[model samples]
Target: MSFVHFSVLKDECLQFLTENAPSNSYFADLTFGGGGHSFAIMDLDESYKLVGVDQDPDALKNGAKLIAEKQLGERVELLSSNFSKFPKLIKEKDPEIEFQGILMDLGVSSHQFDIPERGFSFKYDAPLDMRMNYEDDTIETAADICNTRDADELEEIFKTYGEERFARRIAEKIVEERPIASTKDLENIIFHCYPRNMRFGKIHPATRCFQALRIAVNEELGVLTEVLPQLVELLKTGGRLVVISFHSLEDRIVKRAFKELGGKDSPFRILTKKPVTPSKNEIAANSRSRSAKLRVIERI
Candidate 1:
């Protein structure tokens, strides 16, 4: 399978990262999907070096191939690990490695959703296995979550992560229909949970429910909360951290974290008071880029 991820807000990320970076600076691409941003950053300067990290095995394999094909072998180093553990990984790889810039593009990649077996999209009829790192046995699959979690927990996930208005109703329905075998099964439950009139809205009825399940299974918010501070610490003075989040929950976390860390007496400064979103042209080109919100902070 071809790893085809359109890096959201690509140029904006590069602008922020490279603007204040010194010559020969080192950077990290924490979610190195398709090696898109990593290669773009490397193209900016021959002296610069990048460490590309991704938890997905497919991404790691494709990234290695991309690096080799681009002849970026000497400049880009690809690591197969979750971005949450990036701090420890960097420490072991190079004790003195402090980044001039770090980037995180959160949410599922296009490749993941397009693959039927990944079960990220309702459009596919695959098993409910929405693990970002499917190889990790410890993390529960989406089906496991639906089948095992209580109604209250499911409601909380839908409300907090997905922000679905009818969270309680949806959760109750899911619990009532236990052993959801496939994406279609879950989709049907959510679709019926919506009112007949509201079911034919601009978005699919299953969108929020699926998003909630994926978030819960991955523990995305908790991981992001833990990793944000570490990224700031990994930066050198004047270094920048650029995060692009696709949903409101993620943007809120990034916003709050930046505010907390960018205050007086703190070592960081928020660069964007409001998040930067994708332009009309980018959105037209890749519709998936539409919901992207980018925030940047610099170590002062």
Candidate 2:
């Protein structure tokens, strides 16, 4: 499948990040899934340069091809690394390099969700593997967590990460049905755990469980927590750090970190008092973007 992702809050991000930008400035797109935001920034000014980073090998390959196809090799540099490691990697490459803008569009890419083999969405009946970098065998797969984690651990993951009301019941059911190796297998287990009336509810019973498994498998929250502070420090004075989170957990972290960094003694100021949500038109065009919340903080 082709790499496709709608850059959430594209206009809002560009407006804030490039409002007072100078010539020959640098920017970073930490989660350059489809190069949507990165390419847009480059298109805004010929002197602007972008460092696009992504851990997914597929994204790196696609980004490289797109850069070459667009003949943007001189302006866009693609890196293969998780967003969490971008600060260290950039420092090693050029300690003096500071970005005018940095963006992180968190959560699984649309490509990842559409590809059934990747197992990110419950709609697919593939292996229950949700690692962002599937090539990294060291990372635990969703199947591993479902099959090995105790009911208590599973319950916590469902409750903390997914906020599922039936976390305990679902966790117990997962434990009862061991060796859940496929998405459908796990989905069935979760579906049966829900009340009969809710089986056909607006939301799928497997949605929260799948989300919880993906979060645990990828350590998404922990990575986000560790990267926010580092990203803020990498920004130049007046530079902006823009983060678009798809879930409340990720949004809360971004909100709290921005608030802490924007304290009176701190060197940052919150740009968006409240997060920017998708317009009704955008949400209607792309339902997946309905939950996206964009937050910005500027170094002072």
Give one clash count per candidate, in the order shown. 0, 0
CA shift of 255, model 1, Å: 0.8
List, residue by residue over 107-188, the lDDT tens digit for candidate 2: 9889999999898888988999998899999999999998898999999999999999999998898899888889999888
The reply for model 2, stretches above 4 Å from the true place, is none
As for candidate 1, its clashing pairs are none
- What are the per-residue Cα lDDT tens digits for candidate 1 across 224-277? 999998889899999999999999889999999999999999889999999999
The TM-score of candidate 2 is: 0.98
44 Cα displacement, candidate 2 (Å): 0.6
Model 1: weakest 10-residue lDDT segment is 1-10
lDDT of 2 at 106: 93
Stretches off by above 4 angstroms in model 1 are none
